[model samples]
Target: MIPSLGYAVLLIIGSFVLNLVVSKIRFNRKYKFPNVVPGWPIIGNMLDVPYPAGMWGVDMAKKYGEMFTLNIGGRRLVYLNSSRVVTELLEKRAAIYSSRPYRPMMSEIMSGGARIVLMGYTDKWRNQRKIMHSILNGKQSEKKFDDELLNFILGYTGTLGEYQFNPLKSPADVFTWLSRLPKPLQWWRPFGEKFCETHVAMFQKEYNILLDKMNKGIAKPCFAVDVLHGAAKKEFEISDVEKIYTWTSLIEAGSDTTRVAVLQMIAGAACYPGWARKARDLIDEVCGQNAERLPNLADRSRLPYISAVVKETLRWRPFLQSGVPHTLTQDDEYEGYKFPAGTEFSWNAYSIALNDKEYSDPLRFEPERFMNDDLKLPAKGHCRRICVGLNVGANNIWIAAACILYCFDIEQDPEHPIDQFNTLWEEPTKPPFKVRFTPRSQAHIDLIEREGNIALATDY
Candidate 1:
């Protein structure tokens, strides 16, 4: 018995060694990808990537150049660190790179495969994208939608001081892996399940309200109305659960991302008073001192300086440091490097946006750098998978920034000095300093009061 056991142990060890050798040979034969060193066998570069997943990629790019590969467990992730590679592959070759990776946590467990954001490249995703386009693209997004969105934003920000945590944050990436475990072993299962239930209930409530209004001929031409109307006409198929997830996802996307951008803009205003002064001066130039009304979407073109500020704000600290990962549907090659099918790709937005080659003094908050028309903002991401609410979100930011800058002189609170550099990755609720928003003048206060009342009263 002892001899037989020893032989079995040797056989198992031999098999393991043979598998490792085969894996190495296959990896070497197919691709000469860089950044494969210092990784464990099988697991590969899982430990190499640091927490938050953004800063590590930036550091890796500095060492590995524009493109590099990190094998997380058995999955290969291709990191694109510059605009050149991102544009060439994600934009030019979007047809193959736009598909989402299969994430059991985000898709199957939390959202039950109904969330459009995590859905893989399929007929369902295509159909959902079409619906989103119809509602948020082009003429469908007009002044009414902008006004409604702005109102929602203002209402949320007005209570920022009262909140202990940011309610708008997307589910953390760690949950995506933890959710793969059995329910009994997944500690976050209850919290995630409750979170999903709460959001779904809220979405259902909103959908029902919109449906009632539609029946009464009082519905506005918003996303809910468009989606429900489409469903009524049988133009497409969508389950009740999907409708809830779809509308909620849109709300989360449209609101949460814009919230982060606006919050970052506020931080910028507080940290860099010179830029704030420039923006205010430009706004005053366009609207005239003590103007009759707050800045509106119509004034966007005239306030070029403020526009530059917006562009710089986005480029300096993009809300999503790592843009959503895309999966390759088939084996492909780029720049002599082979990418196997199912290889995941991610654009390191933080690295690309802050690339020294692209932006001079990339860390500095310089709005004028964008004024030369040399730097392009990657705030809305790129290619076919670009954010669906790009137009609406941009308009929202423009209006909010213009109005806020026009009314208030933002400054860092003396009680709490914000470490602008360190706060880039901080949660919204835990901003390093509380910003003081003092009205520039009584006229500014009056204008804000008048506009605020009107904005509150306006029905979308």
Candidate 2:
């Protein structure tokens, strides 16, 4: 019996070795990228990528040219560190490069395969994308809601923040095989179940609240109202869960990123008061010295400097620094390199936006860089999978930044100096540093009160 057990062990070890050898041979033949980050046997660069994935990719890009690869547990992660490669593959060859990689933990368990952000390229995803475009496409700036609903929106946003920063319960998310254990042995199961329940409850509550308002004929013409009132008539096969999550997804997409962009702008304002004052002057010229009214969407074309400031804010510290990973659906080649189907591609927005080759002074907060037509802002995403809420989010940021600069002079707290690069927060999306928003003057204060009262008093 002992000898038989020994032989069984030997056979298992031999099979493992053979499988590794075969995988290596196939990988070498398929992937011709010269700059592969070295890694340990079998594990293959799992430990090479550091936290804050974006900055690490930028460093690697500098060391390994425009494109590089990291083999993580035999899975190839191709990092496109420049805009040119990202556009070429994700845009020009979008037919094969537009799908999303499978995320079992986040999508399957926690979301029950309903999260639109991580959904693969399928008919369902396409239909959901259509719904998103229908709601988020046109002029969303004109739509207005009362302050009470805005407060509820804030509460909903806070709930999302709480869930986002919850501590990780399972390390097996990356190694999906571990997530497939028997029900009782799956350590992450309870957490994922709880997340799903909480997510559903929150989304359903918000949707119902909006739906109630809509039924009463008191709901404003917003994304939620549109979705609840059947905005996408052509989009069939969308389950109730999908519709609920879709509502939350649009908010999720716009909320954190938009908040970060606005905070970054405030940080920039505090850091460089001159530019803030310059933009403020431009705003003043557009609005008035006394601030007769707050900056509106109509003033967007007139406020070129404010537009430049928004452009610079987005470029300098992009919302999706590491970027959403796009999975290739078929075997493909780029620049004499071959990649097989299922290879995951991530464009480093951090690297591309800050690339010295692209930006003259990439590190500096230079809004003037965007003033000229020669310099174009870095692309957020490309092709069919680009952010559906791009227009709404951009308009939000522009109007928010314009209003903040118009209302107050942002000043950094001397006690806790602002570190624009300090991502070490319980939730990195929330601003790490505090700043004071000193009213530009009493007239500005009065204007805020007057407009806010008008907004609050206006019927839905």
TM-score to native of every candidate shown: 0.84, 0.88
Per-residue lDDT tens digits for candidate 2, residues 171-287, read: 344566776778898776787788788778867877788778877877776666676556456435577888887777777667667777887788888887889998888899989
Mind sharing the TM-score for model 1? Answer: 0.84
Clashing residue pairs found in predicted model 2: none
Cα lDDT, model 2, residue 286: 83
Determine the C-alpha RMSD for candidate 1 after optimal superposition of all C-alphas. 4.9
Model 2 residue runs over 4 Å out of place are 1-16, 141-170, 231-235, 373-385, 424-430, 456-460
TM-score of 2: 0.88
Off by over 4 Å in 1: 1-13, 40-44, 47-53, 144-191, 372-385, 424-428, 458-460
